[model samples]
Target chain A: MSTLIVIDQAPYGFWTGREALDMAFSLAAFDQPAAMLFTGAGVNWLRKGQRPDGVGQKSAEKNLSAAPLFGIEALIADEHACQQYGLTESTMLPGVELVSNIRDVLGDHKHVVFAG
Target chain B: MSASNLPERNNEGFLEYATDWSSDVASVIAAEEDVSLSDNHWEIIEFLRKFYNKHEMSPPSNRLFVKAVKDALGEEKGNSIYLMQLFPGTPAKTACKIAGLPRPTNCL
Candidate 1:
């Protein structure tokens, strides 16, 4: 069975995104099949070039970068929302699937969890 | 290990079990970056819970966050700046860790 994780929050800006990603990676680490769907504000996480040093916490970007290592390559993002947020395809990180709505991806998965 | 391997934790080592932001844990990690977890933090936490309940998924970027804040508190009050202000450490990622959720992808 496959697990679907949905993200609608931005990384490094809120706890929701962080927790959600952690859960996704943890699930993957535990040897579960999983895919993440990005919606709403979650698309910002895919945006490349994050510099959170202004504060003092470890860069949340590191977690995102480790997804593939844990076998979590199904990173999806919302294209329309990205356009609305002024984010273009060129600005997103590598391995992101620009989709119309996350629901389409959600439809294919058996188990889904929301972390935003 | 049984289904219930052990009590998750006694709460004594909650802080210790948390992911260390810095490598050196010998000394105080400077409160300058830490922010007090507040109602706003809870609000986001609850939002994450509901979000999970509805979609059974994790939050993506910051879209749901800004939207939720704007919806709950007015537009003026709903910004990444406010999230950062309320949650002392790092705005989104750190606060989420404190909230006991998983680490967000794409952030480190």
Candidate 2:
């Protein structure tokens, strides 16, 4: 069964969310079927050109940009979350699919990990 | 200290016995990496040691290290560029080495 990792928080503020992404990469390294869903504040992570300089943190945008190299290509961001954050598909990084019905998408996976 | 006086270390230069770690050992190793320990460097080294003591592992990567530092210290000190400036290389690797902790297994 494919594992669906749901990221519900913005990156850089807490290690938990970043750790979850690390777990996804690790799982992908082992050839597991893993996909990620960005909902709520997690949508911020998909935004393009994130600096993260003010906080002295590495840009999660960079990591997300490299996610495909780690075999994590199934990236989805919640459409409602994008709207809430006032982001359009053009504003997010490439390779992300925007979904209007998050529940329908979640139904496709057998396991879910909330990385919030 | 001379090489003979140096504490036993693994091939990667991690101290064989964590108890053998001291500011002196850290200084010697940091110097090898061309980093002179400032108060800021010491703060990160101490934090890395404590993190290893508690977690029994180094942070998995630089991103996590920056997040941990930001959470423990603050943003000004926790960012990657600040760490890269002090360590002059990968912060997680260099800091863990000087802190006498094992090389992080997952860092690349």
Candidate 3:
């Protein structure tokens, strides 16, 4: 069964999203079906041109780039969150699908998890 | 040519800065692992360097490392046996070190 990992927190503001990403990576490593959903402030993770090393945090944009390689099924962002964060198609990561119906996305997966 | 001339590395011997990497440095690191560079080895190393440049992170674990290689290079070179043959120990750890990237966080 595919699992949907939800991240609603702001990128770079907390460790929760990174841990969730690790979890998703781990799942993929084990040949499991897993996907990530970015809602609320989490859409910032998809924004391009983040240079966070000066702040002592690895760039979330770069980290998330490994998702496709690691076999994470998909990266879905909430459309409202993208709007709230000023992330347009040109400014966001390539191939991130924006979805308006979170309920439908959640229903597509057999299990759903909300990252801390 | 000399240890003193090498770029700054971490306690685990990872490059402190990925930009510090070069072909000569890769040879030096490979020597430390008792792996002499070959056309086969460089193919994976170059792929790894490119992967790090694009992803900004090492494949965090061996399985993911293999998967990433398969995604890019296809199945013939992506299996654990092929990677382990090129890199004696954990292939992800050894290749990333030689490729001048950060240590894979979950390698152990």
Least well predicted 10-residue stretch by lDDT in candidate 2 chain B: B52-61
Cα lDDT of all candidates, in order? 0.59, 0.81, 0.91
For residues A1-116, what per-residue lDDT tens digits would candidate 3 score against the true structure?
69999999987889999999999988887788999999999898899899987888888898898898788999999998889889999999999998998999999999999999
Tell me the tens digit of each residue's lDDT in model 2 across A74-113. 9999999999999887889888988999998899999899
Error of 3 at A35 (Å): 0.6
TM-score, model 3 to reference? 0.87
DockQ of each: 0.03, 0.04, 0.64
Q: Which candidate number has the best TM-score?
A: 3
Q: What are the fnat scores of the candidates, in the order listed?
A: 0.00, 0.00, 0.68
Better of 2 and 3 by TM-score: 3
* lDDT per residue as tens, model 1, B1-108: 221322132232112233332222211221223544456556665654454333233433343345445665677766877776765544445544444334444343
lDDT of 2 at B31: 79
| Tens-digit per-residue lDDT, A14-95, candidate 1 | 7887777778866764567888887887877777666665865445555576565456758887888888888887887778
RMSDs, each prediction? 17.3, 12.1, 2.2
User: What lDDT does candidate 1 reach at residue B78?
Assistant: 69
For model 3, report DockQ: 0.64
